[model samples]
Target: MHDDAHAAGVTRAGAAFAARRAELRMTVQDVVDSGALSKSALVNFENGRTWPRDGNRDKLERLVGLEEGALTSLYEQGAGMSRQDQTEGLVRAGAAFAKRRDDLNITQVEVAEQKIMSVQALIAFEKGRSWPREMRRAELERLVRWPPGTLASLRNAAATPSPDLDGVSAEPPADPSTLMLDAVKLALTSALDKLKALPADDAPTFIAEARPVMASLRSLQALASRAVRANIGSVSAVQTLEDITACFEDLMGRVAAHPAASLGQKLYVARRKRHLNVQEVADILDMPATTVAAVEADEQELSDDYRERVEQLIRTLTFLKL
Candidate 1:
């Protein structure tokens, strides 16, 4: 899965590198000479063979001059030699990173020279197979800025287990709560806009990420609404979150209710939050011009081709300036 993501990111990097190479009109030999690395190594790198290394990064940077950027991160992550494991306590392979250092489990110093501490630890630690001590846990955690639950896991590697979506994204989620809200918002907006055209992959991915947030919001909403009914709290404190929950729910409903949106509408929502002209939208939906006009003006009842699309368009575009 991480490999899939790495592949996707590296695909982007390959394009970037090729574009830079073309822009500079520098051939394989130019990089070999400029980077002072082996010609075969340079060729292999350009041809997607060699992995990006810290030692070689400076030379590459000097050679390419980073027109927009190099694919260093993706390049390194993709390389088998630099393969990171269990990034930030998200164990790469459970057995691989559970190495014991004496009575305590710690091996960061051994791989301290590596760029990603968590990955290095997992790779080396997995090679050992034992639990780390509390102090070692704290040190490694602070050393890597691990997630909230990892301290306990480090203390008793026997207890805490990694979870799905744990290392799904290596980037620390800005906020778990915020992440959920944003995922829901993203799914809703994406669904409303892309509709059936939404990649089967993307829609599900968004929903999976956002489900936790949505569930949490619903639970909170229920609790708060009950609280309001119970008179356990004042209106001011819970009021803000309560209002936000309502808006979030309503937004989710609109998105889920109609899953088949048009390309124009989706692009519009993504860009200007404005609907295209009736004819353009009609082209997107493969509907009649008159149907589009009637749908847009709300004269026609929402139906198969236009039903969800028009309403979604209105929802996204009605208040938007563009």
Candidate 2:
């Protein structure tokens, strides 16, 4: 059955590709001879025997004069037909996990910091873009207070067929806006918590800690703004984020007046003022990007050896009026 569904999806996507190629008056040899795509891959793609990788898809799209992701989107739609049941199962599991997390007021950042998984991974899982491994799934279930095997059971039930369907109402999946809102709220709450916990008497330490929190606030603000523009988010959420950002800015302003900020803080502020990303700075300093991030975040102590290098970098930034 799975093979049949897979073939159907492949055929649908392949037919579309073939039609487009034909419409363009292009032949298989014509595409292959261009050196952009291999003959075997192109043949398999057009013969409904395989799907194209991202790079191959892009090459083909450009060669055939199709818009970026045009073929990929169609292919996904065709392929999605086969995963409808599994998709439904993941959606249900994700919803359950989200509800439990919300109920506990646990933030995604907290979960990530605990080494359960990354924020991106958590978002993807919660949005049903993918599933976690067995161990990670178990960890998530435990973290959310779900009984052992609860997630497995939900997924299993979704994949299995049901009979005598009477009075069983399916819950609608959460929309994108709702999910984005949840993310904004959780991230905002986490940032606020960090702000509240910042040391009062330690100027350098405060600035170092607050810098990352400030970055998070700005990101959340941007996210909320985009959602509002899309007409899928509430203005009040944006307002709240803006208000928090203003307050945070005021606090950072007062802290900036202090003269005892650390070298790391100075580097961080200068880097941001110049609009240079971590990788850019890393390239300039010939240091690993992760090292730069750690230094800025105060997660790693800057060695004395890097002190001269950091001082020179700051001097350069100052010369640039950063």
Candidate 3:
């Protein structure tokens, strides 16, 4: 019965993935060509016959533009009682809290205004998408007129099953560097999403925001490259970093062609590309830091004197090959 339930969950997740692929207008061949998975594996995955291992799972998620863990969360819904059961238990607990609040004629807004949490966060908790943090859990219990240990007790009851009890070996903790790389990937994905949302008419604002993200990506790429050269990380980590760099460069090229990007924005992006800080460029230009900042902000007309200084700074940056 448990195995059948697990198969059903996997099938549901597979159906979702297949639907997303169709929505994106991608073919199974396209996914195979991208090397995210082989044809047979892709067929099996989309047919709900199997789950991809972690590394392939990450690659597949990236290829489909899904948020990290989108598929895994679905697969967990039926793989075992450990996660799914715990989730359902916690959800029930949240519903009970909601009922209690309703019985008292209290609004979610009223509870949030008392500083227990924001309305969105309270809503997430009530919906069982997440639990309140430890520091806030007690306050939440009190706000809902529950006993002091009520929240903690609920959380404990919903915790993952012990390995000893389940006869399943516990997974080892993740490497610190691997965890950091995962975070970088998430940040890059978020930046890419934000970049896509910017209107073409707002080129100045877009470039201003994008340049910082570009700088951060370059820094992370350098670090990851060094790690790869030193054989300090896994093959998957190296590949993930390379994928992030490619995504960043692709978006940058699209943004770079925007005709409405101002001269100030152009120079600001160039300065960032050269890895020069604003203060450093200001010192070289013999101008105040505020003046450099003003130019980059593109908020006012530049005086002839200021314009000449800016032009000179640009020439210097170019000549130095920086």
Candidate 4:
């Protein structure tokens, strides 16, 4: 077994990084502004949610006063995997992919020749150095004969916040559908923000995850269909408003059901369902209007006790169909 210091260093690499960064008085933006790391990559790595790619790995080690390969070693030690499989949450998934391919005696070149992905891409994926896009990930999972979402589950398991991490908060975990929606939101938003960088054909794959955007786009298509049916007659503004309202309400209901929805959305939806105003709910919870507004907007993360009270109120109201 490893000694205590080494074990602590490996298991708490993120905390170590954070503490070192604090010593240097460096904010997250500071590290990003140095042009050494992308914001997304830094956030995930520093949060212990991902392994750093090779280039970033080197830079981060230098910045954090670690020996060459020290961070990598720490991560591997923590992950209980070899260098080849130490990638973020892809450790098990990558191992499974490699094992399945090897058992069939299929070479990486042969897999690439099948036109699934480039040889280099396959190599990187197997080494856990990079992630495939959702489409490619799904295809790869299928090729490996794994169930849909198996790799996704592994990734989520890797990225899940450590309860010991300070300043990170949690809600009671939601149902599977809600968790899926939250993942969809993160993945879709990240992809959409880089839309211009992607090819035209790649756009459609992300659309399914962008439910609200898709809902709006579908509404427009429906309106066009109705107009075509009417032979270009003028549309009714009232009908349009009603249709829009229905779409919005439907969207809100779905959002409310999503686990990632801010506490505010849940509160708003629950109160609205009971035909109660915000003030009424606020009074019932005995919280100030400002606090209620802040919670809904996610401007504040509540203390454990306070959050428990709010959760209790929500449970009571939900049980009452209010």
Candidate 5:
């Protein structure tokens, strides 16, 4: 218990340095630019449970205005440890920042409304003392960017402004078949974005997630591609569009209903940790770029060669993560 208290106090000082320095009107970007350190490196230092030394302290002091004794105390308290431990300060800072918002003189409701989070949740986050994880800190970090900040992204989610689904009826017949088209189109767009964002080393996990969904998407693409190739009459094209939509609902149903979701989640976790790119996996299998469309839907049957390629991609990811 004594040791835990000591560790918490050390952690708290690191937290205090970040909170106080920023309170003194210094911005993180200011520190990053002046110190010529990568934003992440500075983030790591300010977020450390202990302070960084070996000249980093000098740079930080120049940015935030700390005296020698204060710097030494903070550094000794928070400097060396696991990244997970270091990152906790960011979480703690986020929570602490929220707690003090009232002293900064803002109402919880206003903060919640601004951040697109429930007031209750805002309360929980500020009060919760459990370990902080990346996802949890992400929103908090965004909020802390502005003194008494809020996340625009979360607010935007709330303001998602309904899309014009009326146009959807023109392309697909209004029925259960319509669902398939909708799901496929959504997944297709998602996969394309993922491919564009990730590189080879960053692709495997995404590919694994897409592997099952991709197959179905490809089959749809193949069918859609075939429709264009067949030169179906303009009038008949409407029916083709409707047929495509049917295929979409049929495929998504399977993907969402069963083991597919579990598999995709496992793959997503692997991809996130390994930083693997699905595009690389597709290339390895000699798949075309259109394959990106298929992956998000998990539509591919995966030829034996492709399956082996996927296995190799997974192996590569495991090694990278290590």
Candidate 6:
């Protein structure tokens, strides 16, 4: 399958090269004289006798004012298969990525937002209509919750046939606990905010107010733990949920960790890490937008109680699952 496709690509590329050169009224010698390619190599390529190597192919593309890989795309198209088909491993990997995202109920818009790509570009990459650049691919891998280069391994398998799929499941079971991790984190952060708002001297009032929040956290943790024991998902995910549950349990009675060297720096980092702009954070916290900005800029003095509350929120944000 691979060889047949490759041969077709070479023949098609050769014909395309010849046609484009003719359209431009350029001769074989004219190409060679321009230092784009050698006489023998140019003849072989134009005659469909041989394919050009990387360097020569690049030169040919430049000679014709074609973008890099434009000729290769033509080759792929003429081969009667997509670049995705020729690279089944990549297809499989992409399928796995899609399945994982679906399992999490994560939207493509969310993935694109986190990956910092346009929605159309992310959609094209996911559909195998186009490939992403290296850094972008890495970002996508992270967004999909895979280890780095897990999908990149597909590139190495491009020349081979697809692996067996009958024994493998495309949409494997995912840890149900993992699905709730983000929600739990946000809930815990909200709880911390409420706790921070109470007067430090009012222990009874704090406990009374905190009881419902703690109960909710305990319930979520129990659910997550039950999912793990039931083997409802990946072991790694189960372990992660368990670990985070334990961390939150420990944090329930603990005070917030120290802020950054400055209050403003801490505020800035916390908001950015949560991907919230100042106005959004203000809206959520019920603070004025100008006050949020002023606090972040260190231009306005905040009361000690308000500053402490913000610090607790910042510490809670630190525990956020990214």
Better of 2 and 6 by lDDT: 2
Error of 1 at 201 (Å): 62
* TM-scores for the candidates: 0.22, 0.35, 0.29, 0.28, 0.30, 0.27
The TM-score, computed over Cα atoms with residue i paired to residue i, of candidate 2 is 0.35
| Candidate 4 residue-wise lDDT, 194-259, digit = tens | 433333333443322433243332333333333334433434423443454454455556656665
Arrange candidates by lDDT, highest first: which order? 2, 3, 6, 4, 5, 1
The worst-scoring run of ten residues by lDDT in candidate 3 lies at 152-161
Give the backbone clash total of model 4: 1
lDDT, candidate 2, 136-229, per-residue tens: 6656875786654566556434423345468555976567676666767776787788778877735557655555555556556556665566
- Give all candidates' CA lDDT scores: 0.43, 0.65, 0.63, 0.54, 0.46, 0.58
Q: Which stretches of candidate 2 lie over 4 Å from their true place?
A: 1-169, 182-260
lDDT of 1 at 55: 68
Write the residue-wise lDDT of candidate 6 on 181-254 in tens digits: 54445544654575456544334344334434434444445445544655566565476456646544443433
Better of 1 and 5 by TM-score: 5
Residue 49 deviation, candidate 4, in Å?
32
Models sorted by TM-score, best on top: 2, 5, 3, 4, 6, 1
Clash totals for all candidate models: 11, 0, 0, 1, 32, 0
Q: Per-residue lDDT tens digits of candidate 5, residues 80-157?
A: 333455445335544556655655666778656553366776666565443333223333443344431232122112
Clashing pairs in 2: none
Question: Which stretch of 10 consecutive residues in model 4 shows the poorest summed lDDT?
Answer: 212-221
- Better model by TM-score, 3 or 6? 3
Q: Report the CA-based lDDT of candidate 4 relative to the real structure.
A: 0.54
lDDT, residue 296, model 2: 61
Instruction: Write down the worst ten-residue block by lDDT for model 1.
Output: 80-89
Model 5 residue 71 lDDT?
56
